[model samples]
Every structure is written in C-alpha cells, then in structure tokens.
Target chain A: MAVIDIRIDLKKGVADPEGNNTKKTLESLGFKGVTDVKAVKVFEISLDMPAGEAKKCGEDMCVKLLANPVIHNFSVTVR
Target chain B: MKPEEIRVCVLRIEGTNCEDEMADAFRMAGAQAEKVHLKQLTGETFPEMKRNLEDYDILALPGGFAAGDYVRAGAIFAARIKSALGRDVKKFVEDGKPVLGVCNGFQVLVELGLLPALDGTMSPVPTAALYTNDSGRFECRPTVVRNDNGGRCIFTSSVERGKLMMIPSAHAEGRLMSRDLDFIRKLEENDQVVFRYVRDDGGKAEYPWNPNGSESDIAGICNPAGNVMGMMPHPERVVTRFTHPDWTRNCPGGEGDGLQIFRSVVDRLG
Candidate 1:
C-alpha cells in the first residue's frame, strides 16, 4: 500500500483574497518579517495499491475534481 | 409538448436548498416542473425515485452548496453529474432542450463544462470557473442585471435588449473567470453573454453593483446554441412583484422583474 498527498493552490495570477487577509492579520500581530503568504489545500489519501498506481490515482483525482484547472494548479506526491 | 405540457426538471442534490422555489417558478410560468434529486436520476437510491434525463423538456439546476462545497463550490456535484448522467445531459442539449443554472447552480454548470461549451455541446473539461469573490465574503444583496444576450439566449427572450432587471445574488464564490484568453471575445462574437451586472440607474457598475467582480462585468452567460445558461443571480427568488427589493416604494402589484426569465423559457417551449 502507498500513501498519496496532493497540494492545490491558486494559479499565479489569480487573486487569493483569503490568503491576502491572513497575511494582513499576521502583519498586524507583529510578524513583520512575513513578506508573502499563500494558502494551499492538502489532501492525504491512503491507497491500497503500489506507489506508482497511487501517484496516477492522485493526479487523476486532481484533474477530475480535487483541483480546478481554471484558477488552480496542483501537485501530487506518492510514498 | 405545449408550454403547459412542458415537463421541467428542477434537479438537485444534497445541500441544494433552492429546488422548491425553482420548481415553483417554473410552475408559475405554466410548465409542469418537479424537484428531482440527483440520486433519483442516478438510480442510486430508491428504485421508484429513478428518473431519465430525456424525460424532461427543460433542466434547471438551482442554488445552495452541494456536498457542502468542500473542494470548490460545485466541483463535487458536477463530477457526480458527469459520471452519472453526462451522456444524457449532452444528448438533452443536442436535442435543443433548455438548461438553466442559477447562483450555485451556475457554478455547477460551469464545473460540469455545460456552459461556455464554446467549441462543442459539452467540453471534455471545464473551460471556466466561478472563483472566490473579490470581497472575500459571501455577498447576499440585490443587484441589477442588464440583458445583453443580443437574441442568442432563449432564456432572455422576453427581456428587452440592454434593459436592466433587478435580481438578488448570494454567493461566496461567484467570480466567473477563464484561463482562455479569447473567452470573453468568443462569448461576445457568439452572442453568448446573457447578462451583465449594472447599477440601478443603468450606469457603469462599481464594487457592490458588480457584486463579485466578475470579468467584463459578466453576470450570466449562455451556450452558443442558447439552450444552456449559467448565472450568479437568483431569478427565482424574485419571481413575484413583492419580492423586489424596492417593491414597497412604487408598489405596482404585478409580475416580478425576474418572472420574464422563467416566462421566456416557457414561451420558447410554447
């Protein structure tokens, strides 16, 4: 069996309102060193298959539903 | 079937809260409509609940979160629909049937690749998205939407060209965006733009007036064939004169501004 992890984030040019607001709050709390902040959604799946197959499944899931290509980009890692 | 005989499917899934009102709007427009659950269509639940997509002349997807909008607003619902009734839906559109998606429903349509199926009846993948609002908050407010279909969209048939109609919008993610650079141009060239958010006085829209800050002030759009449409506003919520945000001022008791949207589809069927 293998474990797969997928991370999804907004596309580079897309405006991330939630991430920006979080950055603002952090700055107000005295975290002035934080120059940038971005948010990503992570999904961890335990697949009852080989690592190669698990990786394929994760990519398919991202393309099919986990990540919206219109405004997001995603990466899948299997271990 | 005649207008009165037209059977409209107000399709829904879990977390979809607007089916009843959507069905009511169709009924008031003189069409025989019912709120059909997605599971019923997929035959996943009761055997008696099973329904066929080809059985209806119109399919309307209403608002509210489906599957709690976990990933993206309508991604789960769209995926479910694609796996279960993709072919039937494609055939229904090919047969010239009308499909309307309002608010969250609009998100589902776009995610399902039904609307802006620019190159074909149904794209192999979604070509656009209803992203998070610019305000980063759920905006539930009344807005004026101007009819801009230019006669290409059957859903806006009763609305005069460039006329503004008051409708209410409620959504946290309703900013329609596309990676396709020519998306807006193609929509314009094909006359697929059905509505544009506008100010009450019919001037250029600003922050709240434009609601979610969609590209080109777009609020609603239709497929090239004009049968499929997706809009961020809830026309069904204002199907009566009393439902208008400012009804108390003029107080002319008649059909609501949004009724024309429902009436147009029925008229097309008629």
Candidate 2:
C-alpha cells in the first residue's frame, strides 16, 4: 500500500480573500514583514496500489475532484 | 404542454436550504414542482423515493451551502453530480430543457461546467468561477439586476430588454471570475450574458450595488443554447409582492419582480 499527498492552491493572480485577511491579522500581531499569504489545502490518501500507480491516481483525483483547474493549481506526491 | 403539466424538479442535497422556496416559486408560476433529493435522482434512496432525472421537464438548483461548500463553493456537490449524473445533465441540456441555478446553485453550475459553455454545450472543465466577494463578507441585501441577454435567454423572455428587477441576494461568494482574458467578450459575442447588477436608478453599479464586484457587473449567464442559466441572486425569495423589501411602503403589483422569471420559463414550457 502507498500513500499519496495532494496539495492545492489558488492560481497566481486569483484573489485569495481568506488568505489576505489572515495576512492582515498576522501583521497586526507584529509580523509586519509578511508580504503575502496564500491559503493551501492538502489531502492525504491511502491507496492499496504500487507507488507509481498511486501517483497517477493522485493526479487523476486532482483533475477530477480535488482541485478546480479554473482557479486552482494542484500538485501530487507519493509518500 | 400545459403549465400545470410541466414537471419541475427542484433539486436539493445536504445544506441546501432554498429548495422549498424554489419549489413554491414554480408552483406559484402554475407548474408542478417537486423538491427531489440528490440521492433520489442517483437511485441511492428507497425504491418509493427513487427518481429519474429525465422524468422532469425543468431542473432547478436552489441556493445554500451544499456539502458545506467544502473545497470551494459548490465544488463538492458539482463533483458528485458530475460523477453520477453528468451524462444525464448533459443530455438534459441538449434536449433544450431548462436548468436554473441560484446563488450557491449558480456556483455549482459553473463548477459543473454548464454555464459559459462557450465552445460547446458542456465544457470538460469549468470555464468560469463564482469567486469570493471582494468585500470578503457574507453580503445579504437587496440587489437590482438588469436584463441584458437581448431575448436570447429563455428564463428572461418575458422581461423586456434593459428592465431592472429587484432580486434579493444572500451569499458570501458571488463574484464571477475567469482566467480567460476574452471571457466577457466571448460571452457577449455569443449572446450568453443574461443579467448585470445595476443601481436603483439603473446606473452603473458600484460596491454595494454590484454586490460582489463581478467583472462587467455580471450577475447571471446562460449556456449558448439559452436553456441553462445560473444567477447569484435569490429570485425565488421575491415571487410575491409581500416578499419584496418595500412592499409595505407601496405594493405596486400583485406579484414581485422575480415572479416574471419563473413565469417566463413556465410560459415557454406551455
């Protein structure tokens, strides 16, 4: 069995309202150097398959459901 | 077909709270509307409750945070619908049956690749998205949307061009966005743009008027064939004059501005 990890983030230039709000909060807490904050989502999945096949499956999952290609960018890795 | 004979399926799932009002709106429009659960349509419910998507003449997706709006607004529900009933929905649109989506439901249609289907009836991937409001707050207020489709949309055929309708909107994410640089141009060229947020005086909408800061103040759009439409406002909330914000002040009409939308499609089916 292999485990796959998928990470998704908004594409470049897409507005990240939540992330921006979090950054503002951080700045107010004395983290004044914060230039940008991008919120990301990670999903860890356990698959009963070979590592190579699991990686392929993770990519398929991102395209099909985990990530929206319209405004999101995703990467898959086998763990 | 007669108005009473039109079978309108007001689809619902967990966290979808607007189905009742949506079904009621259709009923008021003189059509037979049912609130059908997603499981029923997918045949996962009891035999007595099982439903076939093709049995309905019109499909209406009401507002609310379906599947808790996880991953993104309407992403989870759209994925489930795409996996289970994608072919059926595509066929439904191809048959020229009407599909209506409001607020979160509008987000679902965009995620399901049904709206802004510029190149085809349904895009393989969503060409546009209903993103978070520029204000970053859940905006619940009255909004005016001007009809802009030039009579190409079946849902607004009864509404005259440039007519402004007061429709209440309640949602956090309603801004329509696209990565395609020519998205607005393409929509205009294809006559798919249906509604634009406008001010009370029918002037260009700013912040609270435009509500979500959508590009070109776009409030709703339809598919190339004009059979499918998705909007970010809650038209069902204003089917009667009593539901309007200023009805107590001076109720000018027996029905509300939003009733015409439901009546338009019902009239088309008739």
Candidate 3:
C-alpha cells in the first residue's frame, strides 16, 4: 500500500482573507516581521496501489474534486 | 401549464437550512413545491422516497451551509450533484426548465459549472467563483438589487428594467469573481446580468449597499438561455410585507419586493 499527500492553495493573485486576518493577528501580537501568511489545505490518503499509480490517482482526485481549478492550485506527492 | 400544476423541486441536502422557506415561496407563487433531499433525487434513499430531476418543472436551490461549507462554500454539495446527476441537470437546463439558486445555492451553481456557462450550455469546469467578501465579514442586512437583464432573464421578467428590489443578503462568501478580465463586459453583451446592487436612491452602491463588493455591483446572473439564474440574496425570506425589516416604519403594506421574483417565474410557467 502507498500513501499520497495532496496540498491545495489559492492560486497566485487570489485573495486569501483568512490568511490575511491571521497575519494581522500576528502583527498585533508583536510579530512585526510577518510579511505574508498564506494558508493551505493538505489531504493525506492511503491507497492499496503502487506509489506511481497512487500519484496519478491523487492528481485525478485534485482535478475531479479536491481542488477547484478556477481559483485553486494543487500539488500531489507520494509518501 | 396552470400555476398549481407547475411542480417546483426545492432541492436540499444536509446542512441546507433554507429549503422550507424556499418551498413556501414557490407554494405562495401558486406552484406545487416539494422539499426534496439530494439523496432522494439521486435514488440513494428508499424506493418510496426516490424522486427524479426530470419529474419537476423547476429546480430551486436555497441557502445554507451545505456540508458545513468545508473546503469552499457549496463545494461538496456541488461535487456530489455533478458526479451523481450532472447529465440530468444539464438536460433539465437545456430543456428550458428554470433553475434558481439563492445564496449558498448560487455558490453551488457556480461550483457545479452550471452558471456563467458562456462557452456552452454547461462548462466542463467552473469558470467563476464566489470568493470571500471584501469586508471579511458575514454581511446580513437588507440589500437593494436593481433588475438589469432587460427581459433576458426569465426570473426577473415581471420586474421592470432598473427597478430595485429589497432583498436581504446573509453570507460570508458572496463576491463573484472570474479569472477572465472581460467577464462583466461579456455578461453585459450577452444580457446575462440579472441584478446589480444599488443604493436606496438608485445610485452606485458602496460598502454595505454593495454588500460583497462584487464586480460591477452584480448581485445575480443568468445563463445565455436565461433559464438558470443564481443570486446571493434570500428572496424566499421576504415573501410578505410583514417580513420586511421596515414594514412598520412607513413601508407600504403589500407584497414584499421579493415576491415579484417568484411570481415572475411562476406566472411565466403558467
């Protein structure tokens, strides 16, 4: 069995309100050097297949459901 | 078809809280409205509970945090619909049957690639998205949306062009955005824009008036065929004058502004 990890994030130039709010909170806490904070989602899945096949399957999941291509960018890796 | 004969399927799923009012709105509009679960339509339930999408004259998706709005608002529900009944929905829209999406419902329509289908009857992938509000707050207040479709949208046919209706908006992510730079211009050219947020005096909307800071103050839009319409307002919650926030404060006692939206579609079906 192989495990696959998928990471999704807002595309470049897309607004990330939650991330911005967190950055503001950090600044208020005296972390002044926080230039930016971008948030992301990671999904870990176990597949009863080879690593190569699992990687392909993970990409399909991202395209089909996990990530919305309109405003999201994603990456898949075998673990 | 007679008004009562028009069967409206108010589609809902777990976490969808506005189906009852949506069904009631259709009923008040003289249509036979049914609150149907998505599983029921997909035949995932018992034999007696099975309902088909083609069985109804209209499909209405109401507001609420479907699937708790995880990942993105309406993402799970839209994916489920697309995987389970995408073909049927496509056919339903292609047949000229009306489809209405309000608030979270609008998000689902966009995620399901049913709205802003500029290239075809239904885009293979979503071309647009409803992003987080510019204010970064969940805005819940009475909003005014001006009809701008010029008779292209079936849902707003009863409303005069440039008429503003007071509908309440309540959501955190209702800002419509698209990667296409000419999105607004294309919608205008195709007459797909159905409503635009405006000030009470009919001037350009700003801040709370525009609510979500959508481009061009767009509150709603329709497909090229104008059979599918999606908006980020709760028209169902304001079917009667008594429900209006300022009804007791000199507001006229009559049908609520939102009623005309339902009536427009129901009357057209009749």
Each model's C-alpha lDDT?
0.91, 0.92, 0.92
Q: After superposition, how far is residue B51 of candidate 3 from its true place, in Å?
A: 1.3
Whose DockQ is greatest here? 1
Output the lDDT of residue B179, model 3.
92
Per residue, candidate 3 scores C-alpha lDDT tens digits across A1-79 of 9998899999999888889999999999999789999989999999999998999999988887788887899999998
User: Model 2, stretches more than 4 Å misplaced?
Assistant: none
Off by over 4 Å in 1: B251-253
Q: Candidate 3's residue-wise lDDT over B169-247, tens digit each?
A: 9999999999999999999999999999999899999999989889999999999999999999899999998988878
- Sort the predicted structures by DockQ, highest score first: 1, 2, 3
Q: Which ranges in model 3 have alpha carbons more than 4 Å from their true place? A: none
Can you tell me the DockQ of model 1? 0.84
lDDT of 2 by residue, B115-211 (tens): 8898888888888889889988999999999999988899998899998899999989999999889999999998999999999899999999988
The 10 consecutive residues of candidate 2 chain B with the worst lDDT sum are B246-255
